[model samples]
Target: MELQKTSNGHHDLSPDRIPENGSPVTRFDALENITEGDTFLPNKSNGKIETQFTDFVGKTSFGMSIFNLSNAILGSGILGLAYAMANTGIILFVLLLTSMAILSAYSIHLLLKSAGVVGIRAYEQLGNRAFGRPGKILAASIITLNNIGAMSSYLFIVKIELPHIIQGLLPDNSDYWFVDGRYLIIIISVLVILPLALMKRLGYLGYTSGFSLSCMVFFLISVIYKKFVTECPEEHSYNKTVPTESIYNSTDGMCEAKLITINPQTAFTIPIIAFAFVCHPEVLPIYTELKNPSKKRMQKVANISILTMFVMYLVTAIFGYLTFYGNVKSELLEMYSKKDTLMLCVRLAVLIAVTLTVPVVLFPIRRAVLQLLFPDKPFHWVRHISIAVCLLFLVNLLVIFVPNIRDIFGFIGATSAPSLIFILPGIFYICIVPEEQEPLKSRPKIQAIAFVTLGFIFMIMSITFIIIEWVTGKKTSGGH
Candidate 1:
């Protein structure tokens, strides 16, 4: 791989070929190569298909694409969703979630439309083609920030939940450093995450990843089951530290939570929902992998993935919120006693899922950073290991210093997730399908403008809201 300098004196990250795969680079073509709106009428004569743009072939089926994409969309963020609901009450949370889901779907539409027009599928390449180096750099930077923040959240869960598991199983709980949360995070990172993170490809880690997904399901079931079966002890072990009971009222054998409330913390729902639907970076890769790639096929995959994740998130959140109500913590698992038999299974599964996920999330951040810093260089083992070590160290420091995962979610959700999910897609659509040639009443133009305007508002408000949150000392959650 060589960094090709464009005619206009800029570094082109979209290389023509990759020696490792002995094939053309993924999605490095210009939009002029394909006819507009004609989504992949592949030439399949005999058993062979023709792709003149590059020798690379896609073997992933449409259904498989949906599974892959849904896995991407559902990660550690689900843990904090109840926290989000608790922050913005049930009513406002639902409204924000619906709007964000719609925006996410439409953003994907714009991205696919633009990429389809140009036959480009890489996220950074799309930016380069639409705008230039600045655009490409910006795209890469946002990916790094959003992905790193996401990975941090995943590890932060490990930091919080793993300690509970360890203490529960351990015969010794007398302030040993081994059982401590801070040291345990580093130890887990070394013993478990490091090896998994070192895996060659995302496909190699599939079984563990799938198992982790199963754990999240168990977590949902545990919440729903425990809500009815288990009654809270008069004194929760951490009751003194976590004073959340006072926030809710018991009325008619149910917790009384408001449907809507507009406090400083309510604004956090924006970033939380924004981060929830953020799998945009993975969209292009999955699009390229579809057996007979087409924007329509990819759109189907995206829709299925989005709907599946939305259902999963909605049920998990509703159950978790209903169970904990006023006592809901940032991470839902923290709300439960470590000794509960049902929740222990949920804990082990989720802990496995989240710890395994650290590596999965780290892959994109490393890739994005490499694209930003070293586009010309091919994969080097030394560089890969070094980068992974550095990233894990940085994440460890963050997890230790930053006790709450929700804060990381809020910050990253506000800053980078919006740009990738909303703004860039709208901008790319405007560039590819120019309004200058379209009629004044063109629906696409109107929709694109509206999308951009909505994106701008989301971005601005998220930042402003977070700033206000920091100033008021209600940085992580609504309560404290």
Candidate 2:
């Protein structure tokens, strides 16, 4: 038997064991063994070696991996950012956004570092290795919650904007059932989202993702274009049911962009920013798929993706906020005149992009549910179909009942965003990386511990603020 090097610098005990080469098996070596159709068992098998080996044997290129990760980072969060800027003024928003982007990149570093040590790529698997089944469950739960929030946010956009698009298309102002976003969401979900979600594999949607991201680019360009064209004192009305103290309550002076602004609603700024950068769950998967998946290479992929999104997000928020200033609603596009031909096209693009994206986002949540409930079972269509149906049902309910898109963004950002981007990755790194390689007292581990602490603090503070808002019956006017 080929003996593996143990942490103690000795060969592991085994029958007919060969002498160790004094080097622990690398992830590439393990991958190579699996490539040769051999079982790539680690020095200490977590009973998930096969799953890890099979799932990560990818052939995707570096450029493709970058594209995949960048797409993951790009989502409906873009819609709320201008509102985030509205709440936290331009200077503060830029600082907060910049800080979150840096922290997100750092968090990915910790995750990649931990994964390299264990030769495991899956996020939940790292959790399992670190803290067993409970860890696995917690990781899966966080991913499910995060993705469900995302799906809900996307659908919420559909519910809010789809009806308006329909209304704008008709010849007259006569009320139609299809013009009601609530009913429209249901119909679209049944006809469009369900079929797409039901697909056994979403490999065909790569081009769809490209298209969806292109829509966001179109959105950003439109936002920029509107900033120049839209007059400073433009008299715009809220398209949806906005909060009491919104557009009508705005003062003439409120038109000027502020260097700093703070209010009760400012508590949500971090959470919203957190929500936008919660692409950590997607990081490892992209790493696994990368052509020459090294921590450094994957780190480069993540850094580039986050940097690109950062520029896009910063510009979008700045220009979007500049366009409406205090008059900007939670959904930036909602700030625009729906009758404007360009704005109409922008709305349709957003609706189509988000509608198609729901199915893609739903995949992870459904997969997590299956992993939690049916860990040992092989693929069965009944279970698959049932889970997808059930997940969509639950998400549809959330999209319908949730007051606005901001709540979805804030709540998930306050909770799962921090966990995925900070808490879990920090904890996983501190726990999974061996003491021999780096002790608990080491700088890296110390930083990771601090990272976990920061996440907890952010979560507790944001949740407290949100609860206070609920108790006082003061909703932040981010969306209808």
Candidate 3:
């Protein structure tokens, strides 16, 4: 037994006594008996520790993890993807999105490879392995700011979309606060999200994950219907669908159709797409709960989730963009006329999907906060509830102030998301898992170094461009 210090004071943190039943996360043996020069894992025969999520151990399956991770990856950020496509244009939008998805998958590979190399699974722990305490804090902070920005995006969707849906359903309503976005978000947090957040284990959330993804699929189907089947008003409706050739042949309505246009506004695509694919923070926890956690098995889970989300993103963006063409709004559904029954149905479905996802996003944010504040503390109801309330309050506060999702997604995606997706993973992989003794001369290390350097450049350019757009008062268009 080792006495782990907590706000409540020193408590026994026995190596084999994890709350997650039937788990073999006995690595705490190293923590309990750590010597000055002890390797993070003692007597390592192989570079792996089979992880079971500390609270939900042995209860999640490979398929369950995939659905949950897919839910995490495909967030309200998808709402703005049509906007991204509009800005980047059709050809470039598809290319950029595809590239970002590939890079995101590669980054996850690096993260998992590094985890296997060092016998660690947690994102913060990977940082600790690479650069000690500061690295851990850095990782925690990135995840914190990134998630807060993301949570705010979710609530931002709720704030903007829910009111529109309610008003659309009852157009004659004259009540102000009755349909106010801030109050509606408060209601949602208290009712829908609070119960899910309060749950002690992640395994139970899987059932909800299925429902959540289904809602998004319904939303996707609705978009396709509105584009091809749902009758559009004369102003918003197209006589014919925009063909691939017109995009290939022209550049007006086919804006951003060029291989790559160098507009500052479209540069925001890096973050939006980055934000769309950011389930990295949740991957390890999901991996821990995987039925037979291994680098190969977990990597497979990651691939399937990413690939599935890529398809969803591509389909949703194309159909939504085709429906509105150059006029696609940041929130795709917002682009549709309010009275259309099919559009209303689409809006309602999306509202439900994003609403259910709030707690899923909250789970990792709470975990990161707890790990940072009370690394060794047992999960206490008081602490858990307090943190959950604080996150809800804090995120909602940001949501209230932030004008829209694009700015939120653009800012966080440019600054924090690149680090989470590209820079940090690259640095951690190079530092922790040196594939060659002279990693300085090693091909893998060189590639990682290039990747991190590119990530920084990408982040810097994105922020600079977004700021320029703000200064110039230029509006961004949407895409792929």
Candidate 4:
């Protein structure tokens, strides 16, 4: 087996051809002339030269593609976004959601354009080609951190909801119901995630998307119905009209005020909402799996996915916010606390949906990290290790810290959200290629400006929050 470099710098592999080193190679056509019996010559690595482009062969349809993209965006974030929006006003929430949708769309488009130029399918690979080792490391770190935060958020949701579901199934005074919430979280994660992680292919999980989508819809419907049907008494109302000065009178008062006040903290939350909806970078593998891998087809898939996600998000945010009104809590479980069996069932459905959805969303991140860290090793150990580590972290989180959903959202938004949603996409776009191609070139300048500006704003807000929290020593429910 011999490997020869073509004049164009691409490697050509052949079996029979005895290629000399440092030869003046003209074209791939010259190498085609060599044959071994009836077969083409193989390369030194005992592999035959294949075509430059691999054929796209995947079972995902446009609908599944949209479902996959939407599920990625709608994960754990939707659980908390309404409360974040309620902190701001309804009008402000709508405005922020719109801005986030646009930003997410632009960021995803830029990532796809970069993928086209580099002829790479993975984000880390593209980052390596575009920026260098440090850039690759940065990309991997950002993705890993973002995913850890996401998984933590999911774990928090599960911790709150799973115990209730278990208790509901048990007798009212059953002695067997002595399981700790944190222990239950670990058990639920193992029972739910390990098998899913061990699967050889991802396509099987596609069906679960239908279940997840249904759960999300049901959760929304339940909230809407509960709000309309079960009315809160005027005395029971946590809603109050207070002067701005009264808001800052005491530490506990400030915490309550922060929930209702529309200030810079509220303004800064736009990027968190944006982070929740930005699923574009993850679309590369989906695009590569398309039956027809053309620019137009890829664009169509992206456009449809983004549009579907936008509508779903808009509806979820509006309904969730309006349902809770001024007193909305971060987690949907807390919002459903006052409801009866029907609403409890809705919460249960959401918990199941999110639990199933977690492995699918987190699998890619685990795969990427394992590949980066242990490129040459078999994947079985990696898969097991990743799941164990994730579960252990969740257990520790639940044990040592009890986070209210709002604090969890704030931590996620401030730390991991900005890097994943803003910094990575902009850097990937700017650093990937020397110049932009075609219709993409027409928009790069504007896109670059918008991404940079948004990134700056997000980082500023995140940093400010961190500083304020540190100085004031005042922590919310989810703060570590």
Candidate 5:
């Protein structure tokens, strides 16, 4: 039997023959015996393998996994997804979705590789191991800032939709926008999100998958029914003529500069399009939940999630774009504002779904900030601070600069969108994993070529759009 040493430097009796005192013993000592019942007994000292395996299965499941995945993909940005697709044309939007999905899958694969080799769980941890403490700080900062922007945008949406919905119910009350309706709505939103935030672990909300998925499916069905069954006014025809010049136009030239403006190169740089498809980093936590956490299972989940998102976004974008045609606005609800009952119902459903789902997006940011500032403290207080801070910022933004939601989407896309979606994953993948542990080392030459090529492409496109927006002095008009 093997001997074991405790932290106090005491030699403990072997497990094969228990001491009369019944002290703890190590697994190596227990392994000396090969009895039938012994296989079922856990090692006296530690049960790392058993516990990890059980946790993996418990943590990973179709419902919760999908909810987390969808939570990451669906955010305030979805409000503008339909409009962005309409602007670019249906075919272009579909192509972009496809490409983005593939790229996102590739990025997740890289992340899984790094995580497996280094035993990293969080994105910040992976960043620290790969690029240094600075990398961790940068990665965490980007995610936090992006989430803040996303939450603020959500608040902006609630402020806009809630007041309008309430006023519609009470047409005589034009004062709904002023007489604490905004404040009430903000309070209601905070209350709804707070409970979800207060949960000590995401596992507690795992049951929410069915509700969230139902909301999503119902929302989609309503949109489809509204788009196909209801007949829009003749004015909504696709062939409708648009005014050549307007105050909204920033350029002096005619608005219709090109019939089919295909910037083969810049076509992929559309902000909202990129925003809709980039959600890889958010999927990192679920890797450990898988029963096996094998590379194959990871790839399957990644592929399935991406495909599902692509199909959902494609259908929604196409239908919304077709319904609005040239009159399309940035927010999908605008297209249904004056439409029949069915259309209005769909718009309201989608708004509710998005509002309810806001807290999931905010959770990650809260966790990241808590890890950074008070890593050693109980995470519950950190969650409280995060909720408070989020509510405060959201309320202030709603009061001060609740500009057009469309423009807010653009601003988020311009600033934090690219960094969160593309830059961070690519950098971490390349830098974090040791050379010996890299799974694709056999094809290092080809892998290097592809990595550099894709990395450079993403970097150049993201940087260029950000720079152009800064230089053009253009301000996005509020409310799509």
Candidate 6:
């Protein structure tokens, strides 16, 4: 594959050919040339390219795009925010959250600028453009790992929450097979998730994503409601055994909110924030589907979506932390009394939301794997079904053996989240943006270099701290 020069003198890695009409080409021209494994190549057989921009025109409106991007931003990570706030105090948590939100928006700006320059909308295509096939594989692999971590976290939620929900709804509180979380996760994966994942297309899942967002809204409202009605030193139950240090005897210092906190556990704070703000993978797809796509317009959609999620995340963390303070569990829903009627409803809604979302998250991981392993192969039912099954099976095993959900949030957030939100965008911008437009020492390129450096530092520091904690046998339940 040779690099083709665009009319503007920018080198385009896209395989799109020019139309006979001699009009300017857009990213849509590249979309026309997408091949198996999400890679593209020039169609040498036909000397002329087809103009199909009208077919995709005006398909997605601005309001709808905002909704979709918001849905992508929100995930199981919200359940961990209160725990994050507990480790870091209110002021520090808010500062970190605000910075992450702004940084996420800025990274999206970088991505949009790079994509526009190369006339390539796909994330992996941008990788290919920037650093060739190895870059493409690296991008796909990080996406796969990031999303597998997402799926594992979702299933982990199901493992912890589903049984309590089942036990709550039953007549007898005695131990039963139906109330075993491991068994329930496996069963649900087979019965519910597998079938949905096997489908050829997921246009219908958009409705489910909207429903999930609604459920999260209810969850936020419930958290806020509990803050007013529930007081400190209140009765809270733990589903798992906790250490003596975890128990609170008085409301004296425990309930008092701190302005800032310094502890080993605080290392997980930024990663958790990173995990919550990762909607980058979905951003370009939303841009592609937008009615009138432009770098500025899509940036607006991203900003609105990130700002809305930022508010939601901050409010949820504050209320949830205030309601339980230092006693809150990593999984916020687990900290409440299992018999609480309102909480049961919240658990059911959360279970439904996360369960349905696993298949959606699985789609990207499967695509990345296929793109890497089966790049040139045509669609085959056997391959599709096999990959979905293997992924679910692996995630189920991960959920069953993992000691707690915090590890998932910490490790995944430390690794994949930074790569997606910081490292990749920074590299793409630095490499794909022509030096003529922005010189090596220019503000944008220097900022991009610093951004990549920051990502590497964060990843190394977080991982080192987590490993030290594990080695010292300091692993505990909840955020700490």
Q: Pick the candidate with the highest lDDT.
A: 6
For all predicted structures, in order, the TM-scores are: 0.80, 0.81, 0.82, 0.76, 0.74, 0.80
Candidate 2: count the clashes: 1
Measured with C-alpha atoms, the lDDT of residue 404 in candidate 6 is: 65
Question: TM-score of predicted model 4?
Answer: 0.76
List, residue by residue over 90-201, the lDDT tens digit for candidate 3: 7787887788888888899888877665444578777776776788789988888777776776777778788888888888674878799889999999998888888875
Per-residue lDDT over 176-271 for candidate 1, one digit per residue giving the tens place of the 0 to 100 score? 777777888888899998998786544455566566667777877777888787554424332123323223333312244646544445566556
Residue clash pairs of candidate 6: 330-478
CA error at residue 311 for candidate 5, angstroms: 1.1
Ranking by lDDT: 6, 2, 3, 1, 4, 5
Look at candidate 1 and give me any clashing residue pairs. 31-118
lDDT of each structure?
0.68, 0.71, 0.71, 0.57, 0.54, 0.73
Show model 4 residue runs off by greater than 4 Å. Answer: 1-56, 169-179, 239-265, 376-413, 436-443, 470-480
Question: Sorted on TM-score, highest at the top, how do the candidates line up?
Answer: 3, 2, 6, 1, 4, 5
Of 2 and 3, the candidate ahead on TM-score is 3
Residue-wise lDDT of candidate 6 within 1-480, one digit each (tens)?
A: 344442112233443333434344454444333321132343234786432221123357787778767777888778888878877778888999999898899899999888776555567767877776888789888888778877887788788778778778885864778888889999999999999889754334566667777888888899999999988653443212322222233322566665675555677556667657887777765665677677788899899989999999999999998988867777788677788999899889877877877877777677667656765465678888999999999988888887765565557656877799889999999987767668999999999999999888878876876777677866533321
lDDT of 3: 0.71
TM-score of 3: 0.82
- Which ten-residue region of model 2 has the weakest summed lDDT? 7-16
- Residues 1-480, candidate 4, lDDT per residue (tens digit)? 344432112332321223444344432233323221112322234465432222224567666666666666667667666666655655666677678777777676667665655544456655665565566676666666556556666667777666676666553633454445676677766677667655554455666776787888888776666666644333443334422222322432322323334543454445456566755435665665555455456667777766766676667666666665546555545656533677668777877777776665565565457436643344366555665467445544643386554454465557556666667667766655444232335467557756867787787877676567656764322211
Instruction: List CA RMSD, all candidates.
Output: 6.5, 7.6, 6.7, 8.1, 9.4, 7.1
- Segments in model 1 whose C-alpha atoms lie over 4 Å from true places: 1-30, 33-55, 61-64, 86-92, 231-254, 257-264, 377-386, 400-410, 434-441, 478-480
Better of 5 and 6 by lDDT: 6
Per-residue alpha-carbon lDDT of candidate 2 for residues 303-376, written as tens digits (9 for 90 to 100): 99899889999999999888787777776776778788889899999778777777767766766676567654
lDDT of 5 by residue, 78-122 (tens): 555665554455556667767777777777776766555444346
lDDT of 1 at 96: 80
